[model samples]
Target: MARFYCDACKEEFEHSSPSKKEYTDSFFGCCWQYVAPCPQCGKECTEKKEPQKKKRTSSSGGGCSSGCCGSCSCCG
Candidate 1:
């Protein structure tokens, strides 16, 4: 398991299956490319790095604002 800092919640979280790791693993899996969103914010950041400390001043704390997983083709 790995720890991912959620900017939405401003806290770190650990999980058995982080989307970042899953995205990386996908390269060796059935898919040649990989992409996923954050579990807390659904952000499209896939790099395995600590999330920047950003004070969330809004109530829409979950998911992303880029309007991904739909018109965006990052999942491909």
Candidate 2:
């Protein structure tokens, strides 16, 4: 499932279709457009992208304890 935001409805909705094409075709019967209609209000909707998570950085100086050694499996 995917999250979508509708400008007309001013709300967020969930879509079961995995891709935009599938979502559009299932709801609007077309796949050429980039935006999909909101299932609640039948208005143009855009897919909501989830924020990417940032990797935690070590504050300690570089060494085996920093998880950069071969035993840590961080530096293959």
Candidate 3:
């Protein structure tokens, strides 16, 4: 699944269903782009790829705990 901003519907939508496609963006001079319908309004819209999400992690990221139990998984 990928996220897109739909200009036709003036909203952000996810394009995961069938009929999603990519084509060279003539407006941008040959950059390939994602084309899909607005999930809410169903109007055809163009969308740039959403930025990759940052992974959620503990501040220490599995390093030694800074709490009561050093070996406890729950300890930060």
For each candidate, give its TM-score against the true structure. 0.29, 0.46, 0.40
TM-score preference between candidates 1 and 3, better one: 3
Number of the predicted model whose TM-score against the real structure is largest: 2
1-76: candidate 2 lDDT, tens digit per residue? 6678888788888877534343346666746533567877787677877799999876455555565534455544
Under the 3 Å rule for N, CA and C atoms, how many clashes does model 2 have?
0
The sequence of per-residue lDDT tens digits that candidate 1 reaches over residues 7-55 is: 6556555556544233235447543322345667776433346558998
The per-candidate count of clashes, in order, stands at 1, 0, 0
Model 3 score (lDDT): 0.63
lDDT of 3 by residue, 1-76 (tens): 6666767666877778535454576576545455777768877776656479999655554555453334566644
True-structure RMSD for candidate 1: 17.8
C-alpha-based local distance difference test score of model 1 = 0.49
TM-score of 1: 0.29
Question: What is the lDDT of every predicted structure here?
Answer: 0.49, 0.67, 0.63
